[model samples]
Target: MGDLMHAVGYRKPLPVDDPESLVDAEVPVPTPAAHELLVRVEAISVNPADVKTRRQADPHGFRILGNDAAGVVVANGPNVSRFVVGDEVYYAGRIDRPGSAAGYQVVNENIVGHKPASIDFGDAAALPLTTITAWEILFDHFGLQPGDAGTLLVIGAAGGVGSMVLQLARARTRLTVLGTAGRGESQKWATEMGAHHIVDRHDLVDSVHAVAPDGVDYIVSPFSRGNIDNYAAVIRPFGHIAAIDEPTGLDLLPLKPKSVAWHWELMFTRPILLPEDPYQHELLEKTAKLVNAGKVRSTATTRLGPLNAETLRDAHARVESSATIGKVVVTR
Candidate 1:
């Protein structure tokens, strides 16, 4: 392996629109730990977290800001058992580590899964982070059952995570999926992604109540700060509310009256804290099965060019715009 490889990274925190925010440079090839696999990154998907992380990047060191990735395993650590050197894999790598913006990365095998055979690298790259998040939020947090009968409301439904949540809820469970989108295109995208009803983001509470007079059984708020109060008002008794974004000044006290359960889904939980948890691996494997079976499809709608400074900057800008309908992926 070479001592240094090409990568797109930033040395100092700056605005996403700044020309110097993301740069192409050379970085050292990382080695795998006992439980890690060294993967040659083929494609990467940019998420809102990438933009958020870049805005808070350290001023001293180069930070590679990417999370969703699909690639081939070039090498494996001594303790790795599920994957071998030639296998293709996909995963949302740990946030603490230098991400998949580079030529290669070291990720724990427990959090990685085999790439879906039916899709290309770009499509496969778009699934891991959002899929992991949606799966955990729906099944683990809300305890989704196959025959469940109720409405599931998803805030910001056109984005990557919400798209997955809509598809999974529609495919695996019998819930009526209600997705919120502000624009006309986003509403269409949400409906095509599996939303049974589209609620306007401008009038979240009323729009949701119009379709679901009895109130929704579950709420997945990908971006929930502004509507937290309304969420408490619209949810049915004993309903569950799951969120993944970082909301400020959030008060759950209002939910007490309805006996609503609040839950938070963070995809990095297993890789960062509970390393022994096999659910991430298990779920990714299941997601691959669902994809191959045509039950769920990729949300990668925008394709930026190769993994370079110009393309990455474009991706970051679009993500910061808060108007992207689906995942933005860049290939090697």
Candidate 2:
């Protein structure tokens, strides 16, 4: 390994169309800390988080912005016990660290998982972030059990996290899954992922009621703004609602009558706040097993190109458009 590595970073936030939004440069290769692994990044997938970070956060200096990655461990800290050199791994790395938008990155071993053997690096890269988010929302936040039978409504069902939620709910639980999509292509994609019914985003309350009149037992929404009223109307008494988006002026008083439970899910919480938690790694391992068993499949629908400033910019633009049908991955 050399002292310097190729990387894509930005000194300041700019529009994706700007040529300097993400610039190619050489940065020093970072060394692994205790319980950390130095990985040679092979593939990366862009998520809304990446776009949001680029648009809103002040890096203060050149900062690499990527979270979902599949790579091979080239080195490890002295205290690392979960993996060794040359192990194929995947993870949604911590936001506080230098990210995967470079030739190599250092991620803690406790939050990493072995890549599914059945998929390539690009496909594997698409799973970690969405998989972690969906799994946490379903099992952790919603407190769902294996034999639980009810209706689960997924808003923005064709996107990365929703796709995984539909698949995991079908494969691991007895719940009837319903997905909302605004377009025909997205509706079809949601059905293919395992949604038993497709709800029109425009007529959320009516369409969701048409499929499950009793009301959905659980609702998971990636796009939560301006939809809380519909969610309140369709959620049954004592039902659960989980949202990943940050919506301003969100009024929860509408759900007071039903005693609806609300949850906020952020997959980075474990890595950023509770670094000692091993559940994220275990969850990823379980997800990898599901992928290997063919119960869950990769949602990488668009491959921009190799990992570089140009491809990363394109990937960010696609995600920021809010029309992506699935994940956009860039390979090394």
Candidate 3:
């Protein structure tokens, strides 16, 4: 096989409402570096990040805009002996790197993992980005005990990241997860995904009171575009809150009364901030093992075939619509 490969890309930023934003094109099949693994992408999933990047694409150069993918490692770099050819893997690749909407992609072995054995490629592709975000928030940032059960609140608990947070908390910890959703379907979906309780986000504080009454031990804000101020009102004293979305004009003052610790879970910060950390890879490997063991499941819904511009555009539209749950994936 030659080095050239097909990929989905955008030459310039366009509104998702516009038709020219995503395009099918050919790009170089990147060669893995000494610490990298070359993956042949069988499936790729979409997150809100894909939509954000698409809207803010740099016109000066072409941008391949995808982050989560499941594939097989076809080659390894010079010092990369951990994985060999033909290993099926899944990962939410680094943010600073070229994306996974392609036939082949090169990623650091540190960030990739073996796909879960219980599911197909499409489902596995949906997990990496969301699971990594949720895991890093509860485990790395808050230092929550995996077995220490507590009253946990997951705001916006019907989306991709929220669903993963629910499953992970249920699987690893005995925490009674109280997830927030506005609609009936989302509420049912959250409950099915392992939320011990589901409440409407409309009357959040009141709804939480009816469920936990004592207040939740931890709050995961997988959605933070709004309601931060309202959340602090109900957060337990000396509790922890972790958020993973864009903070638009948030008031940090409300958290002072509760002695609450607020954290931001940007999964990309690790690879972007400390790219050489071997411990991150160890964590990813462990998470993958859990997935393979059937302890947790993948979290995407839309699975279109082959990576391309049209598929990407459609995925972005769904994400922006806020109606899509789990992950929107493009599989080969």
Candidate 4:
């Protein structure tokens, strides 16, 4: 319980290539508030959200910028009941708070879950954010049941969120998964993650239609900006489309003809706006059970050495490239 700890952060938004975009520093160790846990972060994973936040958030003062993390609970708030000191846990912390890219961070207990004992910190670090997003989309948004059988098309299926979407759907539902990825390695990765059919991203409509001729029953997309037409063309009437990315100038006029339902998923919503909700904790617990049972697997495809300014910068750069096949994690 040191008064201060080492961390990497930025004071202003800058390009990833800038030397000061991410810097090493020492900050006072944060103490847990009501219903919070003070974690000694052991591992962290990078996501497009990290990159987007780095580019958009002002921070004003130095601000740490990572969400997906696995670590040990070093302290807990007075009202905390879900976890205590020495407990291993994983979570995608709230975006409004200081993040997990530090030696210690405080997070609400309701949003945290026990880290699956079967996986190491790095692999466990890669699961929370993406798994929560995928789970919410499948069950909360789509209302998919375990017995319901239909086709689900996941855009950007080789990426972090997409990878989890594929695995969770396979483990929790009876949907025939169709994933969109580029040729070669990406396609292979998607298949290994449980995609029954791999649709080429370049030929979105035709590739999806080729596999599910009648049209897919549900679609989850991370990149929904330029693929709206293709989605509209390939989604069956009354089908649901859930997206996590922010697409500009998005008009739902076209989808109206098919009565397609478009849902937006932001994993941070529950943690930030509805802090009292216990569903994220419950969801992560179920996800851990699946992982420990060998039904869902970690998507940590690239390990970028240890957690530090240099390595975090490289991890951010890799995610910014928009070509990362799976999650990239950094260990302590």
Candidate 5:
């Protein structure tokens, strides 16, 4: 345990456009600091950020990257009382730090939550990153109050975060769920996940009209790999639009007349910067409670083998393909 542990890392950014980019290597096992928990990783989930990071990692150093992980505590830092050693936990660790694609990881106890009792480690692993993102985007950013009688639209409603958003909104809120997905498979996925109506993105406004007849009050789009201009048509007057994609330029001028609100959600914002509110972790624990009660199940559709470079790349590729609905996970 004293020696270095295994990790998935990159020596230099290479073309995922090619294949020689990511690598597996022995890396130092991090020691927990005050308020930190050193977790023995049991599972990890690959996200779009994983692929992006690999392709954009610093060429000068070994860049280790991953985001979502569920594991057990092996050690705890000083002043830590929220968890004891051997407690099973899950968290979408900070994106700025080295990742959970390793044997052990150092993460804050505040960001970590008790693993959902209903599911195993691999299934539990898929929920954290996407859950946090969907929760924040729908509730926090878009301000979709649970019973506002407002209609909520989830664009790209078949992917990981979108799927969770659909479930969470439908389960926790009274807002009518309108899911926008073009593919037949995506539409089926959305319907099964509790969407009131499924709309196509090609002609979003018309598709939305077929269901709402009026318009949606809240719209959330975590799928921004495409352009950002599409939401303007379906979004109602004074409605709110929330997204978690990159800061691509979208004309905000159109949204002004309706007093519409456009907000961005970055799940890592809280943990990466160590914001004043530590209670978000408490909220994630509450999510765990809902999941434990069997109101929700793991979104992970595919599970891979022990964490290694090849497996990590494959996970990343799965994420980047943007084909999988729900999460694709990796476990040891």
Candidate 6:
């Protein structure tokens, strides 16, 4: 309803510890384009993507970097039909556009889903990005059918995306889920999220082999660079490996002998590269159903005050530390 809106963003790339890394400012509320909904963002969750983007040089002046958000629809473009004004919705928005750090953001109606009736805004905000990621990795990339019986090895299972992956794999599919977590608390969190077994990432190969014996059928590595080779070594023939992290100089040759299928899942790809693909919308809607039915739960572990630059910096630091379990959400 107002012209000015509160937003947190950065003018230049800097380390998370830098005071100027993220700054609070007032920006004009954005008008929705065709097929877009203008959302009044109520809560947002910080991901590693937020931290990585902040450290990159942005020639395009100030940039708002947040991926997951839940809010009420303030307005809708004439062409939008999936949502109406006052609808509570959640989504992992497109990276090519301005992100959800602002009080107001415009997102395509197709990529957004109705908020789950079982959760609050902060809890709902925690699901979109990670849910989309894990969903895509399982259904789109891995292509496993329901009642499919096999072992799934999820690296970084205590983190946001992996937590969702563990839950979805356990609840929807018949996959025996093996998750990795180094710390005691993290291991507990992973088990709660539905991992059948917890393996120390330090002993990834031996620990996994001790249980599976013949290697795993599927692998989802949210943070893969360090232990990718171990994954290659422990994967069964024709097993699928999907990753979300940006691992450089990865040698996939080791998988060639086993004919392993490797794929990368960037949650923004459907919204950015293939807007015509309706899978994201379907996945979000299904995820909401799962959450409402108590099949899956929100992973918002830490709430860092209100959505502001100062709090965002703290969230970024926590994510960068790579010790947090589940998702860290910031609310209004």
Best by lDDT: 2
Q: Residues 54-125, candidate 4, lDDT per residue (tens digit)?
A: 999888898998999999999888989999799999999998999889999999999999999999999999
Shift of residue 55 alpha carbon in model 5, Å: 1.3
lDDT measured at residue 98 in model 5 versus the true structure, 0 to 100: 85
Candidate 6's C-alpha lDDT?
Answer: 0.90
In the predicted model 4, the residue pairs found to clash are none
| lDDT (Cα atoms) of all candidates against the true structure | 0.90, 0.92, 0.82, 0.92, 0.82, 0.90
Between candidates 1 and 3, the TM-score winner: 1
Instruction: Kindly list the per-residue Cα lDDT of model 1 for residues 1-332, writing each as its tens digit.
Output: 78788888898888877889999888889889898999999999999889888888573688887899999999998889899999999999999888899999999999999999999999999999999999999889999877787889998888888999999998899999998887889989999999999987788788888999888999998777777789887899999999898887788888999999989889898899998787888999999999999999999999987899999999999889887889999998
How many residue-pair clashes does candidate 1 contain?
A: 0
lDDT of 2 by residue, 1-332 (tens): 88999998788989999999999999999999899999999999999999989988998889998999999999998899999999999999999988899999999999999999999999999999999999999999998888788999999888889999999999899999999887889989999999999988898998888989989999998788888899989999999999998898898888989999999999999999999798989998999999999999999989877789998999999999988888999998
lDDT of 1 at 64: 80
Per-candidate clashes, comma-separated: 0, 0, 1, 0, 1, 0
TM-score of 5: 0.94
lDDT for each residue of candidate 3 in 142-200, tens digit (9 for 90 to 100): 78776987788998889888898888888888898998887788888888899988887
| TM-score against truth, every candidate | 0.97, 0.98, 0.95, 0.98, 0.94, 0.97
For model 2, where is the 10-residue window of minimal lDDT?
221-230
Compared with the true structure, what per-residue lDDT tens digits does model 6 show for residues 40-131?
99999998888888888582888888889999999988788788899999999988888999999999988999999899999999999889
Q: Which is superior by TM-score, 3 or 6?
A: 6
The Cα error of candidate 4 at residue 56, in Å, is 2.5
lDDT winner, 2 or 6 = 2
Model 4, position 328: C-alpha lDDT score:
90
- What does the lDDT come to for candidate 3? 0.82
